[model samples]
Target: VDIEVVQETGSTNADLMSRLPLLQRPVLRVAVHQTAGRGRAGRPWLTVPGGMLTFSLAWHLPQAPQNLLGLPLAIGVALAECLNTLNQNVQLKWPNDILRDGKKLAGILLESAAASEGGTWIVAGIGLNLQVSDELEAQVGRALADAPWLAQMDRNLLLAQLLNALASALQQFAGHGFSAFLPRWNALHAYANQSVHILDHGQILHAGIALGVDLLGCLVLQTEQGQVNVLAGDVSLRPA
Candidate 1:
């Protein structure tokens, strides 16, 4: 894998996607300071220099895009499991958000670009908070991952460990698909088996018990209508 670390960047994911056309080997681009980082629904990811760890990894895949629909969930499983090895209480929210002790600690965004006449390339961007401030805490309207070591851990060591685990997990995912990670994801799910509500905008679309995820990485909700498979998009899940 090729590694490039920048002092600053607009968004590593954007950069990787732009370079995807010419991409040959796997590459990992890390930004020490990300000026323009955004998560799902275009929400800005706030961070300060050395306060957060931001990076993006790009790789070519022989599989078609549709067949990798559950890629994000698999990535989340990789991240949560890595963190769990270092510190306990690492749980995953559906799709791909890392929650530490029920609070958001890190966010992941996965994007794929297809080269003309070739296979697809995917970039997985990650934002992990290293140090939290009262100001940063105030800016977060929702859950934020909080832990004592997050503010004191060694960034380099953390980055190395995470990158290795991610690369290995991605390789396994390419062979086994999301089915292999489903059991692991369910084991670390923060809301598994809990009553929850799936919300789009402010409206509740479905209310049911969270039964973990299916092989395709769709959230399995046991609703009144039946077992409903929920896709991740503009929708949000919350405890009911």
Candidate 2:
């Protein structure tokens, strides 16, 4: 599967990991409309051209699976199993952010490149906001009109069922990694038990409830003064 339907891109995973080693094909897809996209604090992925569903994908991971280190939590369990097939309350927030009823919509950005003589080459980008025009959610300053639980959806059958459930969850995560996707990523977790705000490296780590994600993907809160994993982070679901 090698697709490419572009119009603009400042980051389809950095223009497909800079052309994936002159590509010969190991499954490369690239659907874009707009994305000067960026996230994980650098934040900028509002991406509105035709309203959203930007994309990117490159492949290859022959033996890479050291506990999976949460490759964006397995692309947020492949976009929450493709927004649970459009019934969509879309969960999944840790490490990748996609939420629907809770507001945000979609996002997944995994990048890796360094194979000049080294190794590694990933690209997996995505951005789905299907259609939320309050003038693009106020130019994405954020406040989807008080989230009315994401008022029903359609968007071309939810982007062809979210690219066929993210190509069957990236072919079962490049063939069985992340423990075959941590029990459907703790069943589409969205702030797993609740209290949050990890942010790290500027120190704001106070947590209690979010226990899911540790085979290296880090983030496993549960604190009343106890469990706290986190590794290169961000948590933020606080406000109870």
Candidate 3:
């Protein structure tokens, strides 16, 4: 894997995606200051220099996965596992949100493109709030969460651990799909077996009990209607 750090960028994901055709092996790009980061649904992602960790990993796959939907969830599991080793109880929200004590500590965004020679190229972008500041909170318009132990840890060391975990997880996923990670992911699921709301486009789609994820990594919600397999949507364990 190759790693590069930049003082600032518009978006690490965009930077790597533009170079996908030239990349042969896995590469990691870290941005100390991301000026135009984005989240799910085109929501703006604000980061404070030196207070957040923002990076993107570009990996080439031999072929597209049978299902691409689970990739983000697998990445979330990898991140949660890496953070948990730091003595922090990190949990995963469906799709790719990382939470600690029910507050979002991090988020993930994935983009892919077809390789010119063959197969698919993937870019996984991650943003983690290491030490939230008043400025960040004000910019985000809410109270944000951070890893308390980051104050005592070196950023480079932590980044290395996360990259290692991600590499291992990606290898496993390539071989066995999300089935290999379903058990571990469920164990860390923040709302397992809890009543939750499934929303799409700001409309309530289902109100049901969270049944955890399936082998394909879809959220299985047991609603009064039936067991609904949600491939992608917004889920809230609490009433919205």
Check candidate 1 and list the clashing pairs: 104-145
lDDT of each: 0.86, 0.66, 0.86
As for candidate 3, its clashing pairs are none
For model 1, state the Cα shift of residue 193 in Å. 1.4
Off by over 4 Å in 1: none
Question: Best TM-score goes to which candidate?
Answer: 1
Query: Model 1, 46-146: lDDT tens per residue?
Result: 88666888999998887664567688888889888998888899999887789887888899998887866577888999998776777777887664666
Candidate 1 lDDT (Cα, whole model)? 0.86
| Model 2 clashing residue pairs (backbone) | none
Give the per-residue lDDT of model 2 (tens digit) for 1-240: 677766676767777777877765655454546657786556677655665667777776655655445676877887677566645667777777777667777778777665553456677777776556676777776754222222245544655666677777766766766777776787887767777777455456565677777666666777877887777545455424
> Comparing 1 and 2 by lDDT, which wins?
1
For model 2, the superposed segments whose C-alpha errors exceed 4 Å read: 1-3, 6-24, 32-49, 73-93, 98-106, 109-125, 128-132, 135-194, 197-215, 228-239
Give the clash count for each candidate. Answer: 1, 0, 0
